[model samples]
Target: MSVSDFLAFTKKNKNISPKIRLYLIDKDKHYFINAGTLKNGFSPKLTIANNRDSVLSAFSKMAFLFDELIRLRIVGHSNESDSSELLYLLNLVPINRKIRTFLDWKVFGPEFTRDMSRLFEVRNDTVHCISLDEVTYHPKSKVSLSSMSGFKKFRTDFQKAWKTLLEIYVTEQEKLDFKKLSMG
Candidate 1:
């Protein structure tokens, strides 16, 4: 079964909450999983890590999925050596311009666009493992299990960002479906 179909099955049969399904099994599961996985077919799984590392990995995965969508749409291909480079290029254009023209971003408002931009920056920093004042490190460079205030804040922000992205994607799909119906 396709990943989306598998996810839908899980959502329906496993008693997983809709909130959990949306976060862990995105509607675009097939695209995201295929684009983000390595040759070994291993994709990042959200596990029980310290809050900071967990949030960082979650945000990075979110950003990567969005980048993969953009790459497919704009470049008409998915074999790019790196996705971060594509995101950096896309971010060079004004956020307003992007929100006006892109397939997904066209449905976003100014506030959503601004938040997404900020989230992208955070994703970049996190993926690079840049040391942040808010992140307390263990002696072996592992994330400290200790609770951190910034990690809490980041988790909240990541939820907001992912929600916004999912909403925009759904909006775009609705528009396409309506167009198809109208034409038929």
Candidate 2:
């Protein structure tokens, strides 16, 4: 449904609690706003000086979606993160055979790992200025604009990473379903 339609439905729907309704509205708003912004930016009239903003926007959405997939796979529910909490949790997951296989076969080889590494670096250093590295450098005094080429790489990497995570989630879910059926 469209954002307006969703809003209208939410206004009439009384079964959902205020908190849930608000969350749903916010989720729709994120999609609506992102789609609109991307559409506007893609037009010939709009001169996008740098791709940093667009790349960051795509990376943010991809990261959130990746985190949500992880939450759903592990906890049977989804949660959003505003900081590095999800990244920390992801790091904590043991890189066992199953995960390794998933990353290799289900995803596109080591590209998932590479993309995620780039995404994390860009997210921390380029976007937030919060270094997740062991050797952190002092913040630059001047604002640095990201190169168009770098943004192109970021956009492509984010897409691969997001797609890999989604495929992993789907495969894991199928495995869960098989186990349930076998047990039943």
Candidate 3:
């Protein structure tokens, strides 16, 4: 819809208070160019350019872009549907196999892959668990990340994952574009 149409809707929909409407409009504009798609904030261009977008939001975007990487033939084989394919490969493929495959490809370095693996572990913990049990003691569990400082570290890890994934996505996109042009 046009800007005038949106403004008229905002006027009629009093439930969408001025602040809420403005925030939604700004959010849609910030991530997606148009609100006509009604994606509910589901765009694959989920890179953390600035602090405006939360780390979790970017992580969600990165997850969606995994399919893009698969489509581009960058991460996994398109034909391997059973388990080798990128589709839900994170849950199906063993960690060792994942490391082996990633090591073979130079798009990401060994150390970075290691870090990304750890990040995913944390992400899984955060996603799978229903709620975090309260920790009373000072020294928190090192592995589970049940404390505030641990949660902070999780955020840092997600930020790194988002940035690293964005770099890989851009590099692969350029390579694909060059290949298509050369082929043409």
Candidate 4:
């Protein structure tokens, strides 16, 4: 869509209000932007966008959020650096197929992964034009403003998935901390 459309969608999310700030930058003749916010009461400025990046910036921000959560040990993981892989490295699952089968969806759960996968699929449809129908109809679809509705749906789903992940991480961390303190 347009920058205004992105801003409007972000504005509707109350959680993002106090938590995030979006900035648009011109990098190498292309418009890039980054989303920044306070992390754990400390502002850790992050690059949420890149050159010519559009909707991918939003997806990247979601991934970064999960990465930060995992880094903080708010989410359970066998390793720390796997945060980025968990969010973006889809093929890593096949490389280490056992890790894929072992992912405790009972702990991390499946809802976030499923929603994120859908978001990635929609993004791929927008970017790669692998769908012949999308290649032929997208411009006209945008003219009719139907694409904006789909964009809104994608944005909503992404936000929901991010928020759900955050909640799960925070709750799990709290439980772990409580148990540790009780045992101590």
Q: Pick the candidate with the highest TM-score.
A: 3
Task: Give me the candidate number with maximum lDDT.
Answer: 1
| Cα lDDT of model 1 by residue, 1-184, tens digit | 4334444554355433211111222353322223323112113333324444665767555655454445545543223444446667876764434544553545566666666665555545555664554443322233422346444555555576666666555443332222221221
Q: Which tens-of-lDDT digit does each residue in 1-184 have in candidate 2?
A: 4334544443354222211101111221322112112111111112222344654565455554444445444543222242235447665653343235445554435755544654555555546543222212222222233444444444454555555555554444443332221221
Clashes of 1: 0
Cα RMSD of all models vs. native, in order, equals 10.7, 11.2, 12.0, 13.6
> Which of 3 and 4 is ahead in TM-score?
3
TM-score of each: 0.45, 0.41, 0.49, 0.41
Q: How close is candidate 4 to the true structure, as a TM-score?
A: 0.41
Candidate 3 wrong stretches, greater than 4 Å: 1-60, 74-100, 134-144, 178-184
Give residue 6's error in model 3 in angstroms.
28
Whichever of 2 and 4 has more TM-score, that candidate is 4
- Model 3 lDDT, residue 43, Cα: 40
Arrange candidates, best lDDT first: 1, 3, 2, 4
What range of 10 consecutive residues in model 1 has the weakest lDDT sum? Answer: 16-25
For each candidate in the order shown, give its overall lDDT on alpha carbons: 0.45, 0.39, 0.44, 0.38
Compare candidates 2 and 4 on lDDT and give the better one: 2
